[model samples]
Target: MDAQVSINDSQAVLRLGSRFDFKAHREFRDAVESLLGQAGSRNLQVDLAEVTYLDSSALGMLLMLRDKAKATNKDVALVGVKGSVKQVLDIANFSKLFSIA
Candidate 1:
């Protein structure tokens, strides 16, 4: 997976590539976590349009990030989800945990 992180003001956007699975989990987590930690943003938006597959580990990773953002009084949003990826999030009831669009 590939990721592009961009920030403007207090908001950060993470553009995720296809196939967010266990193989890319560590690197993805590190990049996202670093940005969320070092930046001054209170909001994070994850773009998932390119994602084609998302496994249990990926779901867990998202949950972890959501919880961390909440604990810091920040917000996390999952955007551009589609197909199987969207199904995974829907089945897991992630819409209630974070903003989904």
Candidate 2:
């Protein structure tokens, strides 16, 4: 899995690659960590449109991001999730825990 993190002012966007799993741990965590360093209300968006798969480890990573974001007062959002990836998250009841768009 690969991740690209971009920050604009207080908004940070992390674009995921084809797969989101244990391989993405470092990149994903670093991207979320970037948001924690910013001040004020931060918009941390995880773009999963390009992601074709999401393993259990990926779900765990998302949960970790949520906790870290919450601690720093940053807003966490999952965007562009569709197909199988969306199904996995839905089955996990992550929709209730996160704002999916």
lDDT of each: 0.86, 0.87
Instruction: State the lDDT at 68 in candidate 2.
Output: 87
Model 1 lDDT tens row, 25-61: 8888887777677558988999999999889998888
- Which portions of model 1 show Cα errors greater than 4 Å? none
Per-model TM-score, in order, reads 0.92, 0.91
Show pairs that collide, candidate 1. none
Question: RMSD in angstroms, all models?
Answer: 1.2, 1.3
Candidate 1: residue 37 Cα off by (Å): 2.4
Q: Write the per-residue lDDT of candidate 2 for residues 1-101, one digit (tens) a residue.
A: 77887788778888988988888788888777766776754788889999998899999999998998888778799999899999999999999999998
Worst 10 residues of 1 by lDDT: 30-39
Q: Judge candidate 2 against the unseen true structure and give its global Cα lDDT, from 0 to 1.
A: 0.87
lDDT of 1: 0.86
